[model samples]
Target chain A: MTERQDCASLLVQHLGWIERVAASLSRRNGLSGDEAEDFASWAKAKLVEDDYAVLRKFRGESALTTYLTVVLTMLYRDYRVAQWGRWRPSAAAKRRGPAAVRLETLVYRDGYRWRQAADLMHSRGETDLSEDELGKLLADLPAGSRGRPRQVGEAAMAAITDGADAEAGVHAAEAEQERQALGTALARAMQGLNDEDRAILRMRFWQGYSVADVARAMRLDQKPLYRRIDRLLSRLRTELEKAGISRERVRVLTDEDAA
Target chain B: MKGRIDDAERLAALLEGRVTDGERAALLAELARSDDGLEILGDAAAVTRELEEEDRAAGVLPIRAPRPGARPRLSARTGALLAAGIAGLLLAPLAWRAGRIPQGSYAMNLSRRVAVAGKGLPPGVGSAPRTSVRGADDGLSPGARAVRLGARQVDLHLARIAGDAAAAGAASRDAARLLHAVAGAGTAAAVYERAAAPAGEAVADRDLEAADANAERLAGTAAVRLGAWCEAARFAATRRDAAFFRDTRREVAELAATRGLPSGAGPALGDLRTVLDGGGPVDWAGLRTRLDVLLGAAGG
Candidate 1:
């Protein structure tokens, strides 16, 4: 087929992914039913418009799904930002800083870690603040920011283009089961975490903040922040391993970039 | 700094391109030793990628324009006039060669031209009565054009079914049955999952079961229609009698009315009839797309 046709076909194949991701994002943000459907449809149209020229520009540095996820997430974020006019952490979350510290701004703009947000507070006279203190400051911001896990089951089904094929069917079912198991394990692991560890991990994975952002937010230097992340991952791995999921398997599943 | 950087901060620094060469090497050595460490880094890498994307996307991408030299918008009246002009141009040569318009060729070409012009005409404007095609005053030796048109329409309908042979066959399979043929099992599963979700208002087991049964019925009906429409279209195409196509159209229109499609059914049905009656050339691409979309959405 010609290049244009190939691109169009590729866009069609990934419509499910676009829908799932859009639905996932919309649901996370509390949009439902028709709202969610509209958001997803709009996202699909964007990807498919101009004969899929958007997808045709892919440089192929990362997995196409990951690229799509990133693109959709950014679009969703931008949409919310536009609608609400620049999200800031709750104005009511009292802090020691002279200027109100929006967790998103701290992490996204200044590349500060969650701990660095505390440092910003500490420098303003909230000295010797505990990690829990920092957690309380950012807790009110949102559930999905800074690496909050998205519910992707329906969205994952969108990736299954050929449900009639036995092999694709098995893979889809297995993937669904795996996702459910991981979700359960993740919940259990989160429960085992102290508030500070939970907040840190949430900022790191769920919010998808850079370590530097989290570090800058929480006011810790990069070194201890990295150690904290490694320790948290180790602890989660240990919890999952105890729950009968192997470390190797966890590694494989977490590698979402693997096709 | 020169040795293995065991500290998480140093590794994070190295990942962010803030580390010296020695610190980078040390982190690489540490990652090779610890698989978990590597996994964490991978997670961090994904995070870094998202951050980069966020930075690059200052705002949503701009909308693009349609390609230059795209087809001009032709209104139905304008299109009819243009088609008439083309038909006149082609017919002029034949008329000139005969020293006058030949009776058979003139009638045949006029019928063809009428069909083309009718495509752009509104349904009420130039549409012949449903039964009129059989006795319409076209100069054709009766039923000849109807037969050819029917045959061509049937070929197109058969091809549409052949294109989806796998999905159509699979509709009878367990997985396909799990979802409706149009929505597939994926949509059915979605409906089931939504119904069964415990966090929402408690839906009764009986209600869930009824919904499932309803979904099954819809899927079954749609699947049957998928096959039935193809077969019917094939029959109408080969029957070669204008009356057959007209009657079949009326039959489906009645079915559509009973189902209460409310808006699209009448127009689409009307459009199909117009094409079948040789009002305009069959837009096979447009027909195939419409059929797939309509059948896919068909629950009733």
Candidate 2:
């Protein structure tokens, strides 16, 4: 057979595989059946474009099915990114790995609940993390935007300025000073940590990842990691104390309401 | 960074389930280090699995079916017994070869033996755990030693199958001695459990059952299926015939379901079982590749 005929025959033989790949991508992205069919058609056209350049690249070192799977997946990623702007996962989620990125996308972008996202991830074989673990790892992320940003009304803006009394302004200034002092002390304390220790603290406190999640990510023992966190906390507290931040002051500054 | 050509090939091999244990391990490690690689792998695996499920539902046969009137092959049991006998015969020569090699050359010889057996040394030799001539050598953890010895066992089996009697025999003796040392140090499973355990917590043999139970809950039924698939793949590797692989695949499908696998493994495991039990000429190569990707995800 001629090369074009050979390529055409090959595509015909594996059309089902191509369709399945397109269907899978569509399902993952929550596209409708029509959209899936569209993707499959587009994929086939792309494959046969340039006189079947994609098929010609196959060296036969790996199975044709595998090569095709990888190729189709790459194409799907490009297709999705082109249709919708790129989905950017949070920095913390990215650091935790691909499963975390998928979870974040499902929860934040797709508006799935923690339970639903975890279930989907499990069902799809995308992750092994439990729902509770997923929640802890993602605790630091802000809630997804439920709606578009709206402008503040003049009445609301007036109320905000009108409510700001001199006494309150004075207290706010004092609080801000205290916050700065606390931040400087904490930054200095953090500087003393090695890279891994710093990462542990960042994941645990800053990113709100669970202790177990932190241990798993760092490949450290959970019990020891707990002790290490405690020890690190104590050392930081001491450094803050040395910087003239009292225990009571530190507690007040670190409280949820204070932020 | 964009994936290199070799990365694509490795990913393809992984998806196809044709990689050896060493190749799987090395590829997994590399994937672990790269988010983009991991993302591509996850997508490919999900798509491949879905396709398999669809194929199973439609009762689609493997692309490469056995030819009509193909010569009947040995049963899986008979092939296994033949493999065992061949392995047994290589032991004497392995022992003789072990005696001939100098003690200091054990590490080099082991790598050479693995290469000779047709499985090359794992990528990044500097990063691979160095196996001393004796297990008593300091600085090597029991878990690390177990892994090294495990690789040796696989290499020896491959060598035996490849008919490299000298390499197989030498590997057999080294494996036996290392296994003995490993037993004295600690059971390999316990060593692995300890390594996985959190720091400052002692993992006694008694606690291993509890640990395993916890792991089962965490990993779910898919992990169990993956483990069974790996075992089946190892067995089928010795018997390259289509019929033997089909039988092995069926047996694994049954074992995966009947073993009281937890529900937490969810629809994914169920889908996989359906695919395995589907009536078709088994695409043994494809099944193996898909299992490799699953196994990698399970942190095997």
Off by over 4 Å in 2: A88-142, A145-259, B3-7, B20-26, B60-82, B86-300
DockQ of each: 0.02, 0.09
Can you write out model 2's per-residue Cα lDDT over A27-128, one digit (the tens) per residue?
A: 665454465788888888999999988866654445556677788877776666665556545445544656666677777666678888888878877677
lDDT of 1 by residue, A206-226 (tens): 544456655533334667777
Predicted complex 2: CAPRI docking category? incorrect
TM-scores of chain A across the candidates, in order, are: 0.38, 0.45
DockQ, model 1, C-alpha based: 0.02
List ranges where model 1 is wrong by over 4 Å: A88-202, A205-227, A230-259, B1-300
Candidate with best DockQ: 2
lDDT, candidates in the order shown: 0.43, 0.52
